[model samples]
Target: MAEKGMWPVYGHNTAVHLLQRTLPSPLADNSSQRGFGGPRHAYLFVGAQGIGKSTLAQVYAQALLCTEPSDRPCGVCRSCRLIRSGNHPDFRLVAPVNREGAVDRSAGLLRVEQAATIIRDSILSPLEGRYKIFLLQDMQQANESFANKLLKTLEEPPAHVILLLTATERTQLLPTIVSRCQVREMQPIAPTVIEQALGQHWQAEPKQAQLLARLAGGRLGWAVTQLHNAKFDAERQEQLETLWRLAAANRIQRLAFSEQTAAKGSQPQLFNMLEMWTTWWRDVLLAQANCIDACSNIDLREEITRQAAHLSQESVQKYIQTLKRIEGYLHHTTNTRMALDVLLLQLPQIV
Candidate 1:
């Protein structure tokens, strides 16, 4: 049970330690009375996806509910056991259900009903532990109604109740709700930390791990996803090589490739491809600027190096700006076919 709060699944040790430091220190005689007078009613953890926000929420919950705490929750205690088995009467995790009205396994957004449940349950006294913990992940996805329902609980929480809400977009949350909680902003993992963690935990092939780490943009979850996504890897490699070849030949192949890639699958996949290309080109830009650390195309560093030799810094900057414009157009939900065509035509002009 105590192991549940150990946050072993997370690779960001520094973030975990930071969160731990926020706990009431056992060494302090007044530690028990610190922060909201021994128990907090609510907290907000703001960070990007895969930055261990959810995991941190759970860890804090464990520390709050742990019967035996020695700097951290003792996994062997009753409170820890209940949390581990997901049978902690005092601990509840509110998340969005799937279309089938089932709890989504993939950490769905919070819905109005889920918020209502938390509100209702939070008003009651804990049946087991001294504290009741509610963990709400992806709070930004909560609709207005859901947010409103949650706000009710935040305004008047029961004794010994704690609400932990996590969001990638903190501003999306209502200001009223934000004002009631202690907000903690989690930083993105550094590339070096991510690289080292991946090597230690996944034992990923060195070259592949390095490339994935760079491409993940300091998101360990995304890096792991890319490592496992064989299809995306194959397609990404193929598309990159095609673009490199066309650029090397100084040909206008952008429109054709964009159209072809857009037609390959759904709009989401097309956007993903566009994002991939953006990152790839950005790496080329960084390489041109002699900013080795800024490059994310480690796997294609050789190709980028070769291309940088012939491409001027101004050209890379122009392409990056063009890509940003294309992204903006996509954000406007521009017609995919037209957007692809226009972006494709503009690609060659940048070169």
Candidate 2:
């Protein structure tokens, strides 16, 4: 059963309601002017990855396509059914692609050729519904040429067409593109809200739900995906165990691990590992402060508390800061080995 005031999306009630108000009433006599003044032709949803931008956009599109008498989407309607099945003729999703035109799995930048293809598609009329929706996922991946290719359509899109773009950050996009659409900034959801949804919808065990909620850092979409990803839990356990072992590792052993990690992994893998390390240290800091309830690694409370007792809170805080700085450098520099070596050397030696 759905919760009170719940629309298809979880959390972000304000965003759902705001979008509902912005849509034209389906009961209105003039259906032809639905996208004219009620909701603008173009919109940009800015937020962190997996924060539900694309999910919300699809729901809003379904509402627009529904033939029902309400402003909201009717799940039973033909249009909504088509959308739910991802077979809607008028809806298109454009994402980043590789050189061969296949969608990139590594989340690369949008290619110029892909932008040209979308421009050609925009000139067409809707095949099955009153409006043609073009959902642009990760517009921040567009380079200069790609962004330029989209300007013509954005400046004066077809009357029957609506453009929806999703980006991790608005600043990553060109100013010209940003100025063309109404911007909607999505914020992080609460852990409690995510926890409740996990149990009710995902049928997760209480402890599993609690752990996922804390690790989610307010992104319900991310949390849900992790539940299904088999490797996620395995990697989490592996990483935590390694850190636990390193707590008592000698200088030679730590340096050996640094060599091995630097030799075997790519820059992206290093980035992810560093993020895990950062979170673990954050838990240690929280444990030191006796903020047990606030710790992300609540399942590892006993280990965290024991470690916290041996480590100074100030040192842990400083190490966290160091990781942040190294992360910034890794993002911009190519000297991966040097950075990883320095990071491992700074690993706190606990008795």
Highest TM-score: which candidate?
A: 2
In candidate 2, what residue range of length 10 has the lowest lDDT sum? 27-36
Off by over 4 Å in 2: 1-6, 27-37, 247-259, 262-269, 332-334
* Candidate No. with top lDDT: 2
After superposing candidate 1, which stretches have Cα over 4 Å from the reference? 1-18, 21-39, 76-78, 81-85, 102-109, 230-232, 238-271, 309-315, 318-351
* lDDT scores in order: 0.71, 0.82
Please write out the lDDT profile of model 1 over residues 159-194, one tens digit for every residue: 667888888766878999899998888777777767
How displaced is residue 259 in candidate 2, in Å?
A: 4.5
Tens-digit lDDT track of model 2 for 2-74: 3464467887787777777766765542345554556678899999877889988888888888878365788
